[model samples]
Target: MKHEFTVTSILEDARKKHDALMVLVEQNASVPFLYMDRDENIRDVLYHLYGWHQILSDLMTKNPIPPIELRPGYTWKNLTELNYKIKKEAESYTLHEVKHLFNQSHNHWMSKIAQLFDHTLNAAGLYPFTAPSNLGEFIHECMGGHYQWAIQTIEFHLGDPYLRPLLEGFKSLPEVEAIVLGGSRGKQQGDHLSDYDIYVYATKPIDVEERRRIIGPHVSLMEYNHQFFETEDDGVLNNGIGIEFIYRNLDDFKAMMERLFNGQVNRGYSTCFLDNLLTTKIIYDKKRAYKSLQDTYRFIDKAALYQQVIRQNIPLLYGTQPNYFDQIVKAVKRQDIIAVNHRLTEYFSLFFDTLFAINQINHPGEKRMLEKALSLPKQPKELEKTVGKVFDNITSGDFLKDLEQLTLDLIKLTK
Candidate 1:
């Protein structure tokens, strides 16, 4: 059996419709308004989606033989309630408050997911279901398909001019490799007006910088890297740089798709660029294709730790730690299941400790202590001015001094 995966067929109609909508929206000063309003709205919607899935996963875990009809209740009313709660939260905030609210809401939802997964595992006494299967699978499906839809929707609403250039550039890559789009936009938004975040794949490493030069003035190339990996007893795998091109060749395009389907190659990390999409540009040789699905999977897992540090630790250091942490602790302590659910307790507790450690490390004069806490293998030259510049950027000198006090306090507390 042959599986046919065509990016054009999947995206074309939505892209065209979205472009029309963007044209309409751009008539007035609605673009910025849409951008601001839609950003939070989309995030709220995704949280609700994730919440619905978490609830359903929990329900299924609690009862192995539950009726399928009960699933609707888990989604509709629950999502509605969450939507209301989010709206209410939004209402109480000033303009400055909205930025962090998104992060807080996301963290809360992720915590709920963790709890739901824990309960599910405990109830089943085994991992439930398989890939592209189960309640989580439903959520995954929503994330993959609906997310793209949302991006298209946003693009239609905003009518941003970047979409055309992105599409044209995508058409220019080689024909056989895979293009995997990742980062924030790839994960969330699904609209045509959105900026394109694309990763083009190739069998042999191509000249990414040269391609960027060819794309020229219309596209703005942000960051590009040529990744070369040595395969075990096989030749090296060369991937071109990140490009914002205006055109692509047919052969290069097909090659990109084949490599993508085979999981032969990939682009770099996508944490920053939230709106990117993979184009599957070229496949050099079919039989010589490499397999990297496992590697991609592992990278995602490892990336979670980095995300945790960013989402939880860095935010805490930045004075954005939710006061809800204490509330969570109180709620967990009140629950009779805490002692029985040692794993959950331990996991959250470790997360809490890490958060506190990060806070302490960022405390004033902590730069001196960072040398000790980080325990880097090599001792680089001290750059007090550089450290000071970073401190100033994040907070005033007072915060830096407070960090120093916190570090001393931590040392005493530990001793």
Candidate 2:
């Protein structure tokens, strides 16, 4: 019988395959299985499968799954490293614990995939920028192909320990009110170059020496007090993972959040801190103060915030005589690349702040912005192309025209 490939079919097949795999796992689970020509066992195979499920689950939670585009952070060439990390992370768990985790992740994947519409499942280019394959094919590869591969490999043969110490050390500090894991990893949208952004909120200064004493042993390279935009201890962990220990004054941060929430707007880079606060994962909370603050500001006045951002930034773009456009025009005339770059930066900053507010999302930080903007449901027509044109013509006479066209296109979204 020819097999059908619908959601129901996928689910049924996945369940049957999972049951078969589990049974086989039970039968020869104790017999060491060489996985991928590595010194790995049956437990390693289960954890490896579980890790993929977890990745898919995270992607599903974020709507319109960004192209798996080579499994989030690692490319095809370096996938072995990702796999190695997955295996290392699961090393500490007992066989029983690993089984439990595997089951949890597998069930979670099924639940999230089931929530999708049939059209979305079969639709092509749903994630166009990277992997143009339809969701159904992707699902089958992860679920069906991977499970089949695991079964065949077991016929022949078959895990991130770092989080614990960091949490424990930070939790011990009396001055630390909350420890948050931010950046791309926290958002689950990390690429290969992403790092661990540990935002440490404290009541008082954490002496540089004290921080070093806690975090130094785990990291091979450490730099204390690099004050570029924030005071942070930047270093690379022994495992070659980059980490930044960003310190923030809890009370001051709270106050700033209040102002942003209450309609205050900056000329540029507005809502960035708000974005950071909302997106970060709470690693440690001394007295739940951080949690309370998050709860309090979690739901903002969207319409009000949207209007405030638009009202504050729209005029700065082009509503006034000699606006940002005019300024950039004059700069380009004088061949002032620096001034042109500066105004362009301010222009795009406010442009993005307005765009994100209109879409009802907090402004995610500075990088991968165009990618993020393109993902938003509400955006100007040909956003990527237009933005690209502006940059392409930055030093030419066409610069102002591109900028004006871009600004006008964006402005129309407001109405």
Candidate 3:
């Protein structure tokens, strides 16, 4: 209820955060969290925070209270647009200038605030623009809120990238039975964008926390179980290496080997597991377990396998518009551009797999799906034309005829 209490409480939180940073400087002098989301450096983030303060400072000097717009012409109403603007403008300012602007703006705003009457701040409808919150509460959010953010940003910059170090330590783990490297890295087709497709096979469930600890404050975000049954996904960049981890328990995998590795049609996962077993180059296998995987998949019933997938999924490929082509039509008519694209994409994906099934081809993962399809022996003759039409999501008569013909051609290949 007291004006002094509101103002003092806000500053106390901000002042505490500032004091903590100063104490941190006494021990370790490394400036914290220079890197932010999607690898945006520290200077850019400061520029964004400082922009808000600068606007508040300008309004307070010209008029006691500011408008909701924050600036005369533009406002932070559209946050995504505001972030875009901040990023573009911040590029023009040096890191030093950003710091100076922030400091100057902070002083000017605080000085102006100190001169205001407690009644002018506390009384509602005084500033008709910011109705619900009078003025002190607004300043609290701008000042103390942003200071806490900067301190946290500094803390986030401390960790290293975690993937490479984690894999390096896997060699010493007593639980791990095999460490096999696969995907482009194993197939000798790896480029800069290629991820680490490493399989860490163990007899029991791999200890996740212990794996994270080996890197020791290096990992910022690590995700698991979304990609596969037992796996971890990390996009955190460290030492310029992008890594993806797959953990397979031998006790669990032994059950899946006959179905997944031997080309038994998996309703959910598809046939790429056979491709992985074929292409993987084992790094460290104490019992040569991966060799058995290769041997099992080597003599597949290619004709029988092709019949299984084609029969199951071909009905999906050749159905009428209400079932097949009409899905895209419904989305396009609704003007749901994302839905239109999604429908087309899902159709194309199923179409690709069906074509491979006809060829009895062990389709690799999505890395070079279309390219791989083009190389196969039993694919549709007008494949490139069909691919272009579907991918473009073009709803013309010629495109329709092309898609229909392609579907008919694929059905023939299956037979």
Which candidate comes out best when scored by lDDT? 2
In order, the Cα lDDT scores of the candidates are 0.35, 0.76, 0.63
lDDT-based ranking = 2, 3, 1
- The C-alpha stretches of model 2 lying farther than 4 A from their native spots are 1-9, 16-159
Residue 354, candidate 2: alpha-carbon lDDT? 87
* C-alpha TM-score for every candidate: 0.27, 0.67, 0.53
| Root-mean-square deviation per candidate | 21.2, 11.6, 19.6
Off by over 4 Å in 3: 1-168, 216-230, 233-238, 260-264, 267-269, 320-322, 329-336, 393-398
Q: What is the number of residue pairs that collide in model 2?
A: 11
lDDT of 3 by residue, 90-176 (tens): 889876677677667666666666666666667776654445666676676667777776655545443233443465687678888
Which lDDT tens digits does candidate 1 get at residues 118-150?
233223223333222344434333333444554
**lDDT (Cα, tens digit) per residue for candidate 2, span 250-278:** 99998998787676777667778887887
Better of 1 and 3 by TM-score: 3
Ranking by TM-score: 2, 3, 1
Kindly indicate the candidate among 1 and 2 with the higher lDDT.
Answer: 2
lDDT (Cα, 0-100) at 6 in candidate 3 = 54
Residues forming the 10-long window of minimal summed lDDT in candidate 1: 230-239
Cα lDDT for residue 340, candidate 1: 23
